[model samples]
Target: MEAFVSTEDEPDEVVDAELVPGDSHLPVIRHQTPLVPDADPDAWLPPEAAQDVADGIAQATRDAYELHFTQFAKWCAMEGRRHLPAAGDSVTAYVSHLTRTPREKTGKPYSPSTLDSVIAAIRTVHRDRKLPVPETKGARQVVTGYRERLALAKDAASRPNKASPAKRDVLRRAVRTLDRTTLAGRRDAALMLLGHACATRGGELVHLDIESLTPDDEGRGFTARLYRRKLKKWQDVGVFYDEDEELCPVRATYDLIDALELEGHTTGPLFLRMDRWGYLAPPMQREGKTIGDPTGRMTAEAASDIVERAMARAGQPGRWRSHSLRRGFVNSAREAGVDIVDIGRHGGWADGSKALIGYIEEADAFSDSNPLAQINEAERRKRGAHDQH
Candidate 1:
């Protein structure tokens, strides 16, 4: 019989054992005291299964959870409370503390959405350890009350800091600042134009592969099969040529592709990193074959920085981020009289998304619902008739 290794550090006092068909000689030991009390014996996983469970979650999500849980643990240590199996009242008090406590950098209380994420993080960590997740009913109620209080106070700080939309005028000016002859310049131009045209999130933009792009049959534009991580599916986004060659997304994309081909890369990452000297980083290779590597690919943060730098160089003010391109597309499309449903589909927004609706509503406020515009038009018409008479 082979010795069974316990998953945890505690000594395993095996009271009984059983054998299965595949590994008849190896025993599945049953400990006198289980790690999770009242848990079903059949539901327990072996030590070997830990990595498989962790692999199910995305790396980015796991990183965030680790950070959130660490913060909760530190807070618990300060308050002299257990965090692993947190008490219901202790969870509620933590929620209150988070709501009232101002962040060191921002000097404002954490947003309601952030508070919700923290509570979710705590619940997730408890579940991962096979422990009964603490009831967050009180925590939820506390968050709801915080929202109500924010509404009543009407504090500007309570509002979300939405990224400013980079409309057509700003985009046109920004692209002009780049020197087309340089490889870096061409890549930056393509990145911004393509991002705006497809309304791509920063993550989606950075992950795009060269093979995913297909030139249109009529040579009008390109159709990119972008993988939406949230939807867990590939979505097609079409970007057409603009009348102005300087601002054409299709032209910019082609220029970038041509430059990359000169560097002997026909596939792999659609965007590559470049140094200050304008030298493109070579594709990563393993066993004499190109492979996907973080070193050769642009990060989401880098994409945001590119957008901000371009906007700053163009002298366009206000807070600009990568999301500005997506938001800008929705607002510009709505203003152009494009149907809301069509705009939502192009942007890969789930039906009935509040964020998409908010952009549409903002566009309508100035055009469709402006009472002052209606009054001014009526007065202008009456004055023209009297002048003619």
Candidate 2:
């Protein structure tokens, strides 16, 4: 199959090249292959070219783009439309179809932001192929129109399923369901608590290593050092314990570590995948799990699955997502009158972010001091005063 390779000079030039396969888990372009060793040796990329490409985009972003591209390709195949260097009309039609068509599993149409991602993926793919994306004409207008329609129809019909906060009350109740005697239970319990206390994303949670944890001198809790991908740096965030050990992330984490027999070893992953028989792997067994350049990190998807199963067991079916842990921490903090800036800092949100504002809004919406409740309270007080008079 034909592919494009980046040259130091004339980067936009598309040349006929054979596709070299990479890790089956990742897309083809991510792998480094010999570029037919061009006639001009200087034209060849440095050995680090593949790493350069991978580093240009976040791994999560690359995965999302690949998924979107695959979806578009499948749709094109089904509809008999051109995918590579697709026409403006074709891109618009795909977006339109996504907006209108409900997914088979969820029975819900794609949100406006999701459609935007699909477009981004298309643009990225076209750029990679050294093809000009038809970014103009009716296509841009179609996207604009879809956004307008989405805004106007801001009812439940147009909106995606609303994410509910995993409040303290809900989480406290959920923690009870875990069979703490079992290794899986201890790991999951710790995972949930740490996820909440740290306000960590799935990727961050899964990437944690034993060494990433630093015990506080005060002995109150521990600091979890996480690599923030968006910021492209490492951040050490504090994870404090609750008064109740049952609900304490620090304690739970320690208990999990003890259960796994990884104490005093500041290496390997903090969390490990359980065996088929629901047992934690001994240190000896773990070596086989890391066959190929493994960071010993669990996949974000696995972390999400852990969250899903735990929440389901907690009787919170369809009411939460992987984001619930992070969102819950923010929501709970805000409800406790924590400053918005503090909440943002804790959750790794950028200052004055629209995303931060959305979380604050959701937290306020379900608050006891919400507008509707305040209005109802005022009306009741007024009626009582009038009756007494």
Which predicted model would earn the best TM-score?
1
Candidate 1 weakest lDDT stretch, 10 residues: 1-10
Taking every candidate in turn, the Cα RMSD to the unseen true structure, in Å, is 9.7, 10.7
Q: What overall lDDT goes with each candidate model?
A: 0.82, 0.75
* Candidate 2 lDDT: 0.75
Backbone clash total for model 2 is: 0
- Model 2 per-residue lDDT at 379: 96
lDDT of 1 by residue, 1-389 (tens): 00111134655434556975696777887766666467577876776687677767666777777777777777877887777678878788998998889987889778887788888877887777766789999999999889878878996545777888988888999888999888899889999989898998889998888888998999889899898766667899888898878778889988999988998878888888877777776465799988655548887777888999999999998888888899888877877899999998888988898988898888778785578889988899999999999
Task: Give the count of colliding residue pairs in each prediction.
Answer: 0, 0
